[model samples]
Target chain A: GESVGLHLPTLSVQEGDNSIINCAYSNSASDYFIWYKQESGKGPQFIIDIRSNMDKRQGQRVTVLLNKTVKHLSLQIAATQPGDSAVYFCAETRMSGGGADGLTFGKGTHLIIQP
Target chain B: DAMVIQNPRYQVTQFGKPVTLSCSQTLNHNVMYWYQQKSSQAPKLLFHYYDKDFNNEADTPDNFQSRRPNTSFCFLDIRSPGLGDAAMYLCATSRGGLAGPRGFFGPGTRLTVL
Candidate 1:
């Protein structure tokens, strides 16, 4: 994925409501997918990851769902809070008989929490 | 306890001048990567080092280069900075052979070109 600057899509949800951020990946052979959250002025922090063989994986208060048929991935926050407001990015990579190579990231979504 | 450390959280350089951003890791992972991220955009992979071997992305500009002296440190050098080169530079490390779900990232260095 290329970096197309500015005007990121925004998702606004009331506090305590569940927030779902969606991403459409480019490659069908990508066997690994991960979600990252970036706060203002900070680098992306890894949230959760799932492999192609699994359709869903859950972490503390967060869940990742992958649909390989449509090449779509979604991150769901169980109970949203102001602290959860950040830019969410979904990254994909394929281990094609090589080392764990660089990740290709999708255009991020800016998650905004409402009061 | 920061696993990945990036020096000079902010950098300012003049157009056409050289600038270097540094990253160091304590985890001793064999794979380290550099990514360039502009505001409101996703990070684009610049290059990576596995142990001492360097691999650069095909589309990464010739002006951008990276060096890894050892397993612990990596440097990104921009020989001639353009206004478009200004962005947040992120460093990451992962255990080389796996899917790298545990890749740890640094706090990033934001570059400003005048």
Candidate 2:
């Protein structure tokens, strides 16, 4: 069966350095992708999104690159900070016969910033 | 201003007991969504309200039910929670603009079913 990453969660990054988080999708039809940052004891917050028509999208100090050829996605954060420490998740959505299909989420990456 | 608010940040309930999670959004968005996230996992969509129309995920269990009485408030009701029902419940809202509009999410409610 098609699936996403089934691996460890923890990722440690030095402050002021770049951090990259990766995700993979099982569905080939997914057209919209989103990255969310979830701090401890909080819900996931929207960070950035990229459409299927485009290969990459950038925001504030973050960039999301999509490789549709491999069904892979990555989120890059510049100058990692303690405030940026959190769990990051990537989700994908596509239109189906049942209205707008809900998003399918990757497991998650726990980003730890070392000051 | 906080766009979304969820009540009772932490809830503890006994098995087979009914539980209700409440969410309110000030964004006045036309779409509201509910997601269930277990420990160490990603948020899973339970259902959402596009305007007044409700849509439930096909894999969502029958024990979970959602109600969107208006544009601002959405509720998730667990008819009879089991130990496995313990998880974080998140509520999100988005303006019905296009398919990729960013969604605003509220601090989640952590449920513990014993």
Candidate 3:
């Protein structure tokens, strides 16, 4: 089955440095992608999203880069902070006709910040 | 603030016992979704309701069922829970169509089977 997957299961970065998380998706028909952050004992919180039509999108200190040709996506966070420690997941889904469908999430990458 | 709310953040049930988890949303979205997530894994979609129409996943188990009696409330019922069924159940809501649709998730309910 077509699925989204992450390149790394865990990442360790020092505070005040930049961090990057990578994801790859096999579904070419997917038109929308989102990045979510989940803290321990909490549900995922929306961070940013990018549509297939666009190549990149930025929000605050985070930037999402989408490469449709290679079916790859990456999230970069500048000046990583302690609060940035959490599990990050990338989800993809294609719109069904005029309605919507559930998102398919990747395995997720655990980002650990070193103080 | 308008958001999705799930009740009983933690629930404990015995094996083969029936349990129900509740979800409510103040966003008044047209679609509600139920997902199950185990430790160190991604969330798996079980089913969703678009308005009054119910859409179930092909691989969803028969022991799992959902009910949405109104626009604001939805429930997930597990008929015969087993040890493997212990996981975090998340409820999310979204407005239908292709206008930048995004799911708003609740805190989730952690179910434990004894």
Q: Which candidate is the best by TM-score?
A: 3
RMSD value for candidate 2: 2.1
Positional deviation of A74 in candidate 1, in angstroms? 0.6
> Residue-wise lDDT of candidate 1 within B1-114, one digit each (tens)?
659999989999999999999999998788999999997788888999888878888999999999999889999999999999999999999886754534678999999999
Q: Per-candidate DockQ versus the true complex?
A: 0.67, 0.51, 0.71
Please give me the DockQ of candidate 1 compared with the native complex.
0.67
iRMSD for every model: 1.8, 2.8, 1.3
Sort the predicted structures by lDDT, highest score first.
Answer: 3, 1, 2
Candidate 2's residue-wise lDDT over A5-105, tens digit each? Answer: 52448789999999999998878877788899999898888899998889988999999999999888999999998999999988887644233445678
- On lDDT, the leading prediction is 3
In model 2, state the lDDT of residue B104: 79
Residue-by-residue lDDT tens digits, candidate 3, B2-112: 999999899999999999999999999999999999988999999999889998999999999999999999999999999999999999998978664578899999999
RMSD per prediction, one decimal? 2.3, 2.1, 0.9
Model 2 compared with the native: what TM-score?
Answer: 0.92
**After TM-score superposition, what is the CA distance of residue B53 in candidate 2 from its true location, in Å?**
1.3
Please say which candidate is ahead in TM-score: 1 or 2: 1
Model 2 DockQ class: medium
Q: Where is model 3 more than 4 Å wrong at Cα?
A: A97-99
Q: Candidate 3, residues A2-87: lDDT per residue as tens digits?
A: 99999999999999999999999999999999999999889899999998989999999999999999999999999999999999
